[model samples]
Target chain A: MLRSESEAELAFRREVRGWFERELPAELRDLTFRPLPDMVMPWYRKLSRQGWIAPHWPRAFGGMDASPVEQVILMEEAARIGAPEIPTQGLNQIGPILQRFGSDAQKEFHLPRILNGDAIWCQGYSEPGAGSDLASLRTAGSVEGDDVVVTGHKIWTTWGHHADWMYALVRTNKDVPKREGISFILIDMKSSGVLRRPIRTLADEFEFCEVFLDKVRVPRANIVGELNRGWTVATALLSQERLILGSPGNALRAYERLRRLARALGTRLSDSDKLMIAKARIELETLIASFLDAAEGFRDGRPVDSSYLKILSTETTQFILDAAQTVSGAYAGVKFPMDVDGTTIDFSELFLQSRRLSIYGGSNEIQRDLIARNVLAMPRGRA
Target chain B: MSEIAGDQMLISDNVRRLFDASRALPRARAAAACWPDTDRTVLREFIEMGWLSLLLPEDDGGMGASAIDFVALIESLGDLLLPEPVGPMLATVSLLAACQSPAADRLLKAALGDERIVLAATEADRSLQGDTNHIVFDAHWADVVVFATGETEQFSLRAVAKIDVDGLDALVRNIDGGSLCSVRLDGSMGEELASGARARDIFMRCRNMQRLAAAASLLGLVRKSLQDAIDYVKLRRQFGVAVGSFQALQHRAATLHVACQSARALLYEAARTVGTANEAVACAAAKVKAADTAMAVVKESVQFHGAIGFSDEADVALFFRRAVALTAAYGTAEACHRTCFAG
Candidate 1:
């Protein structure tokens, strides 16, 4: 709302808003957790067919090439109608990486598949031993003439069990420095030795899976960039990743829950509870404003380090969920969803699930360090 | 850019230049003891710049600048920590113009001409002796006051000279060193301007504008404090490294920086919708967020500077005090939230 949008932007927003309200299925609306691929792919393909699936992708590919404001408007309208969360590993990470660093053959094969939901993708960056210190990965991939034999245990591969492929970071050479020896490659989940086991979360759902690759053979041409250049290839989009993660979508959903909780409680709400709800209101509103500002910065090629936005978005979402949990009263600790005045309140599920927001995507602490070292130019200290 | 946008930009640039040339912050610091009476020259410059009537319509003999342009000027005045009460003066006069009476017009014209200082007495202020003695903000510099009487939508505006008010107490300095006083006003006292719905609309608009202006000022204070602290931490050394290099402080600073950024965005957004259907909700959100963010950032900024930040000599200390005062100015964050939901 801060922007004096052109008539074109306004019209775009209205069109998008109306479409989501009309076309989104009632079952998919306002889901507290991500639905499994089997239930959500049809909706994903619907968005793809509408040319709105890859708003950030270039028009040269099968994408809408929407402007930054248009992209934000798309996200807002989607969240407004409570559109179910869709898998974005291909749309956000692998597809963009391929466009930037992939060969024409690689692009030609995978780009359209991603746009049409024909290939479900998952990121395989975090091996069991390589998380925040991701460069220290020991997952080996050795060249065998025309192929690369890969063996690695990738943990926290979101939707990996259902994904058709994984874009992985493997150690192509152990002789060079940790960051220098890594390679970004794609592996077929259907390969002989590739196995995925779903990991049950605290919320008792299989939102993530552990993917194991035992001598899995993939073509050497599947590598996204020059071997041992994976670190830079992946990092070229670090700021962009932060921008996508820092979006107000999740926070808005949590706020919708908070409003519902507040409305259900009504005059029964205590002053202290009301105050907490008010704080959440302020935080959510600010999160939205902050996202818009950061998005504009991203569009203008302003080198905006969105580490702070990431922290704000996740923490604000968690804060709103906290308020929701607080007002739940006797329903606060219920493991399952309960009906509260006709609204299904999944207080515990949403609240517990949000803990991953801060921990995933380079943990908030790592984000802080990035801001300190990169943005503030603070000197590195031994501690 | 459109002509109006270009003009607004020019107006903002001129205001920034005027504040730079006046050296208003140093002057305010030097005359700290004078409270509301200090920095008359800068205040006169603001009036001469035609900002006091910026929000009034051209039909009322004003420049009729939009609230968006007006907010830009107030944000600058805030960032510079000018002690002139220009924001309060402008907000109060703009409300006075809504009365559309001979008495209101006389007061408005006189104030706009830089002839006198006028301030609004809001309902949010504390009343002593069961509503007889009303506490008014910026009363030390005021020659006249425009206050509302009656209840709800039936309210009417009344104007009174400070000399005409009974039981006028000594000026009480606020946390930021602004002047306030308790004055007794019987129901029938000052010259009545407008009654019923018209007066209610005036009072309502005046309150909303005050909240917004205060929020903008808070944002300015937060920005200055956070930036000064960031600069200070880069220079201040401890344990053989700049203090900012440490993760504990760095994380806190980064969080506050984001808070400041978001608060600024909300303020500008809310300013854009000043007269729209979403005005109440947007304005309340902006005010509350700005006030909360200002307190968080300014307080942490003081800590980031070590012992020096706690002393009066440090500039951040001033921002800290101003943040405290402004957060409670139009309405407390809690009050704004209540009003937002009450509707």
Candidate 2:
């Protein structure tokens, strides 16, 4: 919006802004906590019906085919309205992967359901022993007759308990290297031997869980790509997912909360508080610019080190929430949402929830290691 | 990429080659202990190449480039640690050209030729928000200083020749080995360029442009320091291994590298908003982010170099000095935050 956007873009922004303001329900406007699926799905389906869901997808795949700027506009508007966070494993990750690598039959079955919110998908990549080092995942898939029997444990599966399906990486070739032996498969969450147990987060929410798959049998045709090539298939669209993760939308929301908290307290911010807030604001602006930089690089076929973007974006969001915690003063330790005038402000909920930003997707430590090795070409230490 | 971006890259490449061949750092070091003076050979080459007139109107013997292009040029200069006061000089002339006054025209001509007419500020022009603090940058090299005075919406531009100024302090050596001077201009022998709202509007525009240029330069400084540190860590061994191979140093370097890139992206994006309505906030944000990033990079870069980085002989030390001055130039990070949040 600051860069002298085109007339059409401005008009488009105005349109999106108006639609969000008018259509978003009052109950959903600015929740301090993550709304459960039952409370948020209607809104999600509304967006799907409005043809705004999966803005990054192609129109041929039941998506809006949004341009990058249009996609940014959509995100900005959603953040403007404080839209509820929806399950996005289907939209951000698997939808694109399936578009690229799924069989025609799989596309015909899953794409429409994903768009219409009939299906909720959770990624099944990280196992008990393979969080950051995902290549070492030991989820076994032994083909027996027409079925591939899957068995293993997957941790940190977001929305796994409520998901209708799980896209997974399973070891199909035991003798090969860890990464090379894997295969990508989709499984029904309701299938026998598949069990989900929600793990409580530090934020005190059941946002993610661990799933135990014990000899779950799935049709061999459920495989997305070639056997022993799940590593390639899973990583094919990671840069795009990282790009979405690296957007400044979350940081903007966090900064808005910080500003609101400062205003609600009705006290003069000390010099140090002001300085921290300013630093956060400045970092948010830089994150916005870097998102554009990487997106532009992506469009130009230039090498966009999405790892750097992910680190900057996620860490900046964390930094802002940290600032908010500082500004919260005596309210910093408050456990529940406090009514500051007409608004309910949770001083610690966001501060606690944001801790996951640096830990999930890929830990910031892993991201830093990747950047050091790939971008800087630093030597691998002889272990 | 568009043709303009292609042209920018070409311009950046040429500028890099020029600085690379000119032994810029050595010359800067040689002039550090001397009175405020830049290499005339390098300055003359720069002027002859029309860099000083980059922001002037095409009708005024210049290319009429946008602030984005100006940022491109300044960033390259900063990366090589060029000793000349080219950035300030360019900003000074750009302001003059925008004024469209006879006095401004005369000063612009002198600046584009050989004289160094750097931008200055007095206490009266609060619009710049405590940028100068009564201390003028590159004052030792200035043949004249152009300042804006009067109230916020009623500013007036004035030019004072360095020789006629009274109560001007002797050139103080800066951390970057540049020259700064405390001046008390009592309005003696000063020529007014314009008055009232016209001057105020032009002055604000010039300030935004200058902020963008400084931010771009600070980002350049950060990139150089970060790259140098990265290179050093790979070559320097510790515990019978390259220091860069250590997770601690690698993570630290990676973090700094991200900061450098993020600030740079902000700088370039902010440069594009120069003439837009959002220019003020965008420029302020860019300046604050770049300044903070530069400080972080320079500090960590010194650590990466170990004790050798603290020595005067190390170019990283010079970069630290330059970052310190430049970060304070347009506005300190605190002052800029006040301006941004207040707006």
Candidate maximizing DockQ: 2
Native contact fraction of candidate 2? 0.74
Off by over 4 Å in 1: A1-22, A58-60, A64-81, B1-26, B35-39, B57-64, B97-101, B126-135, B151-153, B167-169, B182-187, B192-195
Q: DockQ, in order, for the candidates?
A: 0.44, 0.66
Separately for all candidates shown, the number of backbone clashes (residues 3 or more apart, or on different chains) is: 0, 0
User: What lDDT tens digits, residue by residue, belong to model 2 across residues B111-224?
Assistant: 777665556552332323244335566776677877776675556678888787754447667777676666655433489887889887777777777677778788777777
| Model 2 misplaced regions, further than 4 Å | B1-22, B115-118, B122-133, B186-189
Q: How far off is each candidate at the interface, as Cα RMSD in Å?
A: 3.1, 1.9
lDDT of 1 by residue, B234-280 (tens): 88988778887777888887777777777787787777767666676
lDDT of 2 by residue, A1-383 (tens): 35677899889899999989998999997776768889888888999998998887888898887766777788778876788788888998889889999999999999989999999999898888999888988889999999999999999998999899999999999998788999999999999999999999988889899999999999999999988888899777576678889877788778878877767766577877777777777788788888877777786788778889889989999999999999888889899878897766769888899988888787889889989999999988554
Candidate 2, residue B151: lDDT: 77
TM-score, each model? 0.91, 0.95
